[model samples]
Target: MNLSVGITLAAIMTIACYSYLWRENTLYRIAEHLFVGLGAGYSIAMGWNNVKTNAINPLLNDGQYILIVPLLLGALLFTRFLPGSNKWLARIPMAFLVGTGIALSARAAVLAEFVQQIRATIIPLNSVNNILIVVGTIGVLAYFFFSSKFTEGIPGLKYGALVGRYVMMAAFGAAFGNGVMGRISLLISRLQFIFGSWLGLM
Candidate 1:
């Protein structure tokens, strides 16, 4: 409950979690389950608070009748626990949630991935970097063009496609290296926390 005691407890849990690096054991399993349980409890509490403020308060104080629709749909999700044919009632809410989620995701993806990417690619070909960007963008797009036969169609289509393939591979390799670097940074930070804060061996 005290600051130092809490920090010590956290350090112990961290060590228990890292113990899995050597081999699976009781300590690692206990830490993992504790983490999952705490996460679920926190999520439930946050969701409850959100619904009370956003839905219940608005309906009661602001007289917003429209909020009742979403509340009803959310309640219908629990019908999955009911017996027999009534269990199918859960699908109504589930379908609405899935459909709305897909529509929102698709809209955002189009704006961010397609529209913004194309806008960024339309740079003036003045500098060498700009020319390379243009060429790489075209080559990547050409690689995905399955309609035309790259080998037999245009004069330089085959070579353009080949360039695109290499560009994609280079992009993938860079992304992978960046991900590894980020993970290594996280590992180093954790190690520092254990040595400096927990063990006092900095």
Candidate 2:
């Protein structure tokens, strides 16, 4: 009984969400608002649970006073609600959060992007595929040189930059196609759910 109700509700929501294909109507607005509200509520719940488990519970039960520092910084996040100069309190934690995030991400990004790319590109160019890979990598870099001297004044680099432009175009086209395919896949799944789960048609 409950399963049927859930499926019915899902089918209704799916239809409501897709109703914007015809025109933006009240049904689409309601579905959009409901989705936003649910997302916000879920985020709040998850954040509260995280704080309780990682900070509050540990501090209270184990007398871990160090957790109070983070808890206080987190509380500073709410100070954005205050007026005038007081709102600047939020900037303290915000700066810490941004700096920490950038520091951690930059470390990982250097390994993933620079180190991995270099490792991948430095392979022995014995085969045709390896040669293409190396050439393509050089071409892409040449394309982004920005200086006319390096990209155009240099003969080989000029051609490499042209190849790079085509390579970038192909990559962007592939990405766009993948995005379209993903949307189509979602539509197919929703249609299957509406027919098979709700209507028992398939």
Among these predictions, the greatest lDDT belongs to: 2
lDDT of 1 by residue, 1-202 (tens): 2249877888889899889999999999999999999999999999999999999999999999999999999999999998888988889999999999999999899999989989998999999999999999888878887877998876677888888999999999999999999989988888887788888788
Q: Which stretches of candidate 1 lie above 4 Å from their native place? A: 1-3, 61-63, 98-113
Native-referenced Cα lDDT, model 2: 0.91
Candidate 1 global Cα RMSD: 2.9
Provide the clash count, candidate 2.
0
- How much lDDT does candidate 1 score? 0.90
Q: Candidate 2, which segments miss by more than 4 Å at Cα?
A: 1-3, 149-152
**Clash pairs (backbone) in predicted model 2:** none
RMSD of each: 2.9, 2.1
lDDT of 2 by residue, 1-202 (tens): 2257778888899999999999999999999999999999999999999999999999999999999999999999999998777998999999999999999999899999989989999999899989989988899999888766753476787788889989888889999999999999999999888888788888
Worst 10 residues of 1 by lDDT: 1-10
